[model samples]
Target: MLKPEDFRRSIVHEPGEFLAILERRLRAAGSSGRAGPRARLLEKLSTCYQLVDGELSKAEAFLKKIVEQGGFYAELFKLEAGVEPGEVLKRVKALRRAAGNIYASSRSELKSARGERDAREAFRAGVGRLVSIYRRNRKTLSAVRRVALEFSRMPDVEGDLRVIIAGMPQAGKSTLISRLTNAKPEIGFYPFTTKNIIAGHLPVEPYGRIVLIDTPGILDRPMRERNPVEHRAVLAVKHLADALLFLIDPSPGKYYSLDEQLNVYRTVQNMLQGKPLKIVLNKADATPPGELEEACERVRREAGVEPLVISALTGLNLDALKNWLTGLLKTGTRGF
Candidate 1:
């Protein structure tokens, strides 16, 4: 029962050791000689891992051999660890793009609706596109936009401001979501605890509605396959964020390493792709005073963007964070 953690720990500094692990897994997974296309592909990937850091010529030769054999792993291996840069680019060009066209068109339609084109039909069509656009990209950003758009159309939920609580898994995402909104998300101690997206509302004054999103944590562990959940959750924030409450944990185990935390943050940041990104440091109670300053410094250096600090466990800074979230939604700036 070897896990990805084993491979990551073993290969942190040595590619050779990593290759050995891959070979052993491939063999154990019944991807041996003369296997099915899938198996053969896995076997080829094993070989690619073995050859990754060797001389460029040697790497090129190994990859060419895999292409000759042909299998699923051939494409995956080539894109991820292919020896030749040109080959990698060729593979990338051929790869099926994710979340294509639908959202882009919706974006254009939204702009058209906002401009002098203020046709009632245009506004109706603009928000209608959200249903199609966001069903696949469920997250706070998407959820908020959908809610806002639909709310505008309907008489019921209009004026609901988006208050997003975003962070990696186990970073108090659910706790904050529950505290801010009426939505209840499954809270757990493990990584990637929430598997589904949960929506709730915040009770504010005047217009007084808040969109609270409880999203599954983005696991930062070594990935054997692309995380579609992570992709969807990230895309939600990227395309749909109004205001973000990003959480950071300075605990031991996987996420404590600033590199790992930053890596997950970058994925979310890339998903946001220039959307307003705010930072919040979670788990201050868990962060010992001795490590607090150092951890904050690490977060400042590595987190994709900067955010405020709050302790979901002790309710420390939660009020301030909430007020900031409210003010941001109301005034279009979180008192920045």
Candidate 2:
């Protein structure tokens, strides 16, 4: 048998199951994702996956690639929906147009801010109002961006990322999210605590400036089913997030055991649809160093991705995680 370490180092591609499913569905529908609704939907899904998986940096690449592929995804989407993705296509085009506007406007405003427009109290007030303006005009703001990131695009109404944090209810999600960011999802030792999505921002000094998002935790099914709140959190991540933070604890049932929480990991592994993914090994403080290392090795062998080993309670490795995540901001390439 392949040793855990051996498997960990092996080069296995992260299977694009989600994309394949969408492709297959499109084929069944006989539409193919050809530059229409089918195409736009696939692009949207790919962008969403990138955001949820802590891989937003890769999103534009995926979009650009799809576009270059001459509407492969568009055909696929059309194939799946069995309808002209005309409406979806229009929305996508409009979103792209809006992205250009935001960038242009930001450049002008950013320049004014630097050129003394910011010297006056009015400018200061304007800057202060950006957040609220962002909150109030969030729908329009999100409307301009191709990929969803901030709260403006969030379902139900305009809100912040704290909305996402409150949604994660797993044992360590709140603790970790609150510790790393300001969203504060109500930390607790017990399960089923966070009943909604709480969002927070991780300050980044990337070179000098950047932003990282901390999302709610996700525990696999079964236990999640036991708590209706958790199920909603999972669904919300699927629908709203640009990426996901999936946490697994083997002995999560008791909190101190070393059981390899394969169930939750497996559940997410299958549901993942070419989305960028981040695996988190929370409670690293609770386990022995060697045990945590071994657990990580085992997961790497199976999951084929590196994990963020952390102790939310003591803040161990949290800084590193934040820095690492901040490096994945996809701001400049927003519209592709």
Candidate 3:
């Protein structure tokens, strides 16, 4: 249940901005105290060291926490941003080392200072060195920021029972989730409408709660061939699924043919790794009887399971679907 919101709020500053802010704060502090010039210079240098050290330490800790809690957020950054958490952690450690070196050099320079002017010069030199280090690793910090933003947008799915609703594009996965839980994902006629992972909770009587997650449309293709939206679905299924509801659109004018839908289902099936799965034939209210029957037969013959026929649009057989899910929660079997 490690989620994006669980991460500490970190604001990444650009190299120049970070340097400028530190210098500005130091100057303001240096001008205020009534101590001798040397004492004030020492105060400014100490303040500068604290500022740089604190920023780097907090950032390193944040990255460490994310890597330690490797779950949905870590996989998500890998899939979308191509930024590995370990690599980012290494970069942060590198920056910390550079800052430590600069601070050490500054301390040595101050110890040998002949006058106030020498201390002032050493302080400026230290600030300049830190700025140079940050500038050299700008791309690394940018990647870190991108990962942080993506994590912030991820949906929180902390629950005992997580059921992922997955299918081809234009399948009624979003509508079905809205029907079952309080999550009202944007419903649309076009493909790939549900672009993000949406989580909704259903609190049942006697049993506790079920977290239903609606994922983006997954195409019938290999993992390498999937787009980011499709990868979102895969990540949810791979990491968060306790049970899965693979929806199939059986309408004559369905967005994808039953075969293609089944292919996507097979792809997800492999990702399930033994999680209970249910094949649902959606759009029964719109599908002709022949198409529905053919869809069910194909699922049984090919996918080796009885497809639960339900009209997510008309609320048909939804009670049966709910009953099946609640039964899973009750018995903890979640058997298909």
Candidate 4:
């Protein structure tokens, strides 16, 4: 997993603001040193070049990691930023290279200068060129900051077993994960409350850890028609889920019809591609027994899989669901 916390903590400032701070540091360093005027000027110029190179190098390294990791970070940058991580990395590297070339050319000129004045002029010109490069790529630098901040908000899923709880709007997926694990996702009586991937953990002794992910509500639509929130669920199902728990709301007040929910299920099933999928019928407490049985029969007839009935609200048959999860995970067998 590409942990967002691994990103650099250095605050990326606006180019002008960064230059101002660097000038202040140079002034203070010069005032505190006991060197001649020419020596002080050259020393500050050297320090300025090093500072610019270091900052650009750090940003380039972080962007490279995001590209190389190519898991959640890469997908997220592509989906949200509308650009690939590698593309952004290229821009950063270009800025660094431009600055490095300026500094190298200036250093060569300084070595061949006839006097201190010429050397000072060349060094100052190089410093100004580096600052120009930084200022010209303000948008690129801001993108680095935006990526770091966005990734910081991502959920952490550092567990052994990764299970995605997926379903239509108001399907009680969030409620069920909250009931089963310590994660308390924002629950509401509406659609699409989970706009991002929320993770909950349950440790099963020596058997290892189980990570339950609650995904945003997915409507039955084409991938191009899906919103960013729904697309995030699709991405998680594709990349992160080791197993899936598809929750179906069969109550009278369900948001989407059984046919619609099944359509979404088929999409997720395609993403799973034979991964372990546990179909769970939620809101059993609110549903009539006859209607619930009919829904179960419908699911079995259409999806060709039996579903476990449980009420996420009233904790009906929840213990059984937990036991099944633990047993199946422990033995690598699929049965209730």
Candidate 5:
């Protein structure tokens, strides 16, 4: 299986790098052979041909795993259906076949040459053939380059338990993650500050490790209206989360009204598809007592679950919330 991090390490060479690697191998082979001069040249060319074909094979295998194993990249690949995956595969195979034929034809010419000058000319012709092969496949190489960059930006979330923080914009999801773990996601006072899914880890002794995910704010609107970045956040919530912490901002002057925030809550609840969830009322220190009580009552009435109140900024009631999470982990309960 391909984890999200695998994409970063996978090699997607540029045309120059690919050709340079083959050229270096060819030169090394030509210089290292102990056989006669003619045999040495043939050996070098054959080795260079094998090196080029081998790299293509490796690239093909890597792409196949990324597309077929089914992870974040697989989903993205499916979305880019217009850029047929088969086309990339076909180009790779064709490039390899053309390279093999060039090598074979060059080898025949080298053998048929009557003198040293003729053999040297054949060798130069072989190098030209290799260059022509690369030129013909330039577009295919560009496609691979584009795909590699797309996959490299994906977040790597790996652990035994995945806890995703989801809420409307400016709901303190990032702050909560910063406080809970050592991971420091960029913090801002504005909406949609977190544009991607950032992950952190909480090591709870005697229980186990918990991977905490901080996702971009999900607006209360139709899914089709959301941009690609927001859609990626939705994908994290839908596919990556084991449990969700839906944070609610009840401060009087918050960006979204209480009802609007709750609307997003309902939207997220539906998106979770029965995943475990906990509604947390964040920024309690900023909310007035009367308004806080009303918010709590509203959540209880609408969500039918008692919400946890904690100020991520001031650390109020955080210990209690942590204990609650520990208890949940200990009991293996799905919902609170």
Candidate 6:
């Protein structure tokens, strides 16, 4: 499974640096044939081969993810190739084959060699072949490196219930996510505080986990006006959200007017295509009593659903919200 931390470590560089790192790891993996029985040496050799296979397999998986789930990266790949999604797969296969050839050659040499010295020589030859393959496929490896880095910026969310916290800039989505889950997304007062999707998890007993995603703050404007990062956020809402908490700012100094916020909500609602959603009136603590009432009435009249009122900053009514969500999960309502 892809965990949040995987994003930090998944990017593999070009074959040159990658091979060097693998070589160091292999050397530190201990002598496969250190002054032991022949069987022991063979066992070590097998383990080493498995290690190489495993690492290459992981690299291949990363490439596949870039091609499949990297969003903009996948689009770029398609535009560059003018083909379907199999180009990266082809490159991954070629890289795997090169690594496999080294392992096969090394295993064969070890089987035929007479002594420990010869076995060690065979292993050295295998590492040399790995370096040679990397150098020969420098171009492909370079492309892989670039794609890996590009894709690493996108968050990987995993859980039973995927809940997206989305709203206009400064809508308290980040604060609410931090309060509801274990993720501490950067909290800022400025617009576009969050430029990418940030993921967190809420563990509810007997109901498994809920993956909470804090998406980038989107403006109340046409989709064409949004940047690529905001576009990715919209795509996440469309594709990843099993449920959504669409936050509406009702504060007097809110960046966008209540009507503009509602328009953005409608845009997201349309994008979601009937996925479960909760229209949350955030910043309730700061909103005036009359203004909050007006906003509530307007939301109900406009959306035909009563908006949930809560102050994410003050933790007001948050427990009740949690209980309500828990009930939804238990009943499997709204396809939770």
lDDT of 6 by residue, 158-194 (tens): 6777888899889999999999989989999799888
lDDT of 5 by residue, 137-173 (tens): 6666656656666666655566657788999889999
Residue pairs in collision within model 1: 141-240, 238-272, 279-307, 279-308, 280-307
Candidate 6 whole-model C-alpha lDDT, 0 to 1: 0.75
Better of 4 and 5 by TM-score: 4
The parts of candidate 5 lying over 4 Å away from their true place are 1-5, 22-26, 32-37, 78-156, 331-336
The 10-residue segment with the lowest total lDDT in model 3: 2-11
Give the whole-model CA lDDT for all candidates, comma-separated: 0.51, 0.44, 0.83, 0.84, 0.78, 0.75
Clashes of 2: 44
Model 6 CA deviation exceeding 4 Å by range: 4-10, 15-58, 65-85, 94-143, 146-156, 333-336
TM-score of each: 0.48, 0.44, 0.91, 0.90, 0.81, 0.70
lDDT of 2 by residue, 1-336 (tens): 111232122111122433354345434442445564433333433333322222212333333333344332333323333333344344444544444444344434444453343423332332233223234433332322322221122223122221122212344766776676565456566655554445555544433222223333444446425443444445544444434566655332444333335555565545445545577787776777777788788778877888778777888887786655554442321111
Candidate 6 lowest-lDDT run of ten: 76-85
Cα-lDDT of candidate 4: 0.84
- For residues 244-330, write the lDDT of model 3, one tens digit per residue: 999999898788887799889998999898888999999999999987898899999998899899999999999999998998788
Per-residue lDDT over 91-143 for candidate 1, one digit per residue giving the tens place of the 0 to 100 score: 32222121223334534444445443443344344334423222332332222
lDDT of 4 by residue, 70-137 (tens): 97768877887778879888887888788778878887777677888897898788778878777888
Better of 1 and 2 by lDDT: 1
- Local distance difference test, candidate 3: 0.83
Candidate that would win on lDDT = 4
Clashing pairs in 3: none
Cα deviation of 196 in candidate 2 (Å)?
1.4
TM-score of candidate 3 versus the correct structure, residues matched by position: 0.91
> In terms of TM-score, how similar is model 6 to the real structure?
0.70
CA lDDT of 151 in candidate 1?
21
